[model samples]
Each structure stands twice: as C-alpha cells, then as structure tokens.
Target: MTAISLPSAMEFIWLEADLLDSHDYAAWLALWTATGHYIIPTERDAEDYAAVLNVVYDDQEMREARVKRLQSGLSMSASPAARTVRTVSRFRAMDGAAGVFVVRCAQHIVEYKYDRTRMLAADVLFWLVPAASGISLQRKVVTLINGDDALHGIGYLL
Candidate 1:
C-alpha cells in the first residue's frame, strides 16, 4: 500500500475544488481515475445505488461527454459561465483497505451569474488512491443538504 499523508490528501481535495471553481475542466478530469464515478442521489439517506433515483450518476464516459460539451462552447447553461466560489471544510481522511483513502468534507458553494446568486451546500465523500499524479478519485458522492428539495439548472460541477 502506498503511504499517503492525511495532509496530502486534504491538499488534493482542496486543489480539486479549486480546479472545479476555476472551470478548469481538463485539470479536474485528470484528477479522476478511468473508472471513477460521480454520484448525487435524490434520497438523503439512500444506500442502495441501484434502487433509488439519482440526481446525477456520472461514469467516465458521461464525465468525458460533459466536459466535451462544456469545452465546445455549446452548453447554453455555461454560455455565461456561472462563476463559483467553493468553501470546503471539516476535511478528514481515513485509510481504506488496498491503499485507498476515504476523504470526507463539507462544502458550501456560492454561484453568481444570469443576474442571480445561488448557494449550494453538501457533504461530500471521495474514494481516492495514490496515483502517479498524486491522487486519483475512484468515486465521489455528494449528498446535498436539501437533496429532497427542488434545485434549478444544476448544469455545472458542484
């Protein structure tokens, strides 16, 4: 198992958020492994992934397609490019078996564009491994604080 420090793990998470906020899709995509998944479930306490409806469940292919759309300048939602500021806190890391690390953090993001500001909050979990380029995400799960409520035009990464 590759030994990775907790501080290093936190740094990696911070950098990921920064990249997303900066709309650096290429860099953000590079932080994930080929088989990584991004999940946002509709149920706040949902455990069975296959049973409940999901707000977003993006695999590698889906992620790539989304990035492609974002880069192509064809996504109307991103035409004005909502500028975002993300605050990640309460970051903690745990060692998983087989050299994997589980990172948990709370995130609050404020987005402004289209003449309106929106705030989103969530608890995020990341399964990561120490890879050649520092850390690679194996899975990312985000449970919105108000997952059961209505959300509008969530076309960008959170």
Candidate 2:
C-alpha cells in the first residue's frame, strides 16, 4: 500500500469541509471508515466522550440515520437547514498507531439562518486510517471554543 502524505491528508480534509459546506451529505458520509465515530463534546477537555455529555456522538448507523433525516426534510430544525461556510486550516499531523495518524486543525464556521448570523469556532481532531483508496476517517472529535456554554440553533452537521 502507498503511504499517505501530509498534502494528501490536507486535500482530503478540505474536500470533506467543502462537502459539508455544500450540504452534500451523501458524499460526505462516504469519506468515513465503517467504524468511524463523529463526536462533538460539550466539555472542551473531555477525554472519553462516551462517558460524558456530548453534543453529538454518532457511529455509522447513527450517522446514516441523521443523514436520512437531514435529507428527508421532516425534522423541524432541519427542514430549513442553516446555511454554513466552514474554514478548516492550521493543520498539524502526528502519527498514531502503526498505520494511523491524527490531523489537528482549527475550524471556523459561519452559520446563517432566520436573518441572523452566528460564528462557531472549534479545534478539530481527525483520526485517519490508511485504506486501499488512500485514507478514511476513523474518528472525528470537535471541541468547540465555547463548548461549556449553552449552545443552540445548530441544525446541521459540524
């Protein structure tokens, strides 16, 4: 198998961000490994997300269900999903296990809805595993800058 490079990892991350900004859930979902986890912790310093109260902690099945709901236009909060533009940058990579690596980046997202605009920033970590296709996301943890504060009106993916 060919080794993945830092530039390639950055490219893949950018693609994922673009897919999210465009609301292309299907394409975005395909970027994950079968056992991939998508986690958003309410506590900025939480180590084990399963033991803590998280804004989101989804596995493959939950992710699929969420995508279905977001695309179905049935849920009130998601029916008119907030438009978002995300910028992911300041990428730093570190090797994890034998074939896995972690990419850490800063993400700033601007969400617009109901004539109001909100800005959310986070430090995101993506654990990536090598795959035949190059790389796939094994885990994603988003630690919001103000995660301990009350947060609402988020109706779409982060």
Highest TM-score: give the candidate number. Answer: 2
Candidate-wise lDDT, in order: 0.86, 0.90
Q: Over the stretch 1-158, how does candidate 2's per-residue lDDT look in tens digits?
A: 57777888899899999999899999999999999999999888777889999988999999999999888978889888998999999999976777787899999999999999999999999888778888899999989998889888688999
- Model 1 scores worst on lDDT over the 10 consecutive residues at 1-10
**Judged by lDDT, which candidate is best?**
2
Q: How far is candidate 2 from the true structure (C-alpha RMSD, Å)?
A: 1.1
TM-scores, each model vs. reference: 0.92, 0.96
Candidate 2: residue pairs that collide = none
RMSD in order of candidates: 1.6, 1.1
Per-residue lDDT tens digits of candidate 1, residues 1-158?
Answer: 35567788788889989999888999898899998888898898887765789988899899999888877788888776788999998988866667788988999999998788999999999898888777788999999998889988875788
Clashing pairs in 1: none
Error of 1 at 48 (Å): 2.7
Tell me the deviation in Å of residue 93 in model 2: 1.0
Candidate 1 local Cα displacement, residue 139, angstroms = 0.7
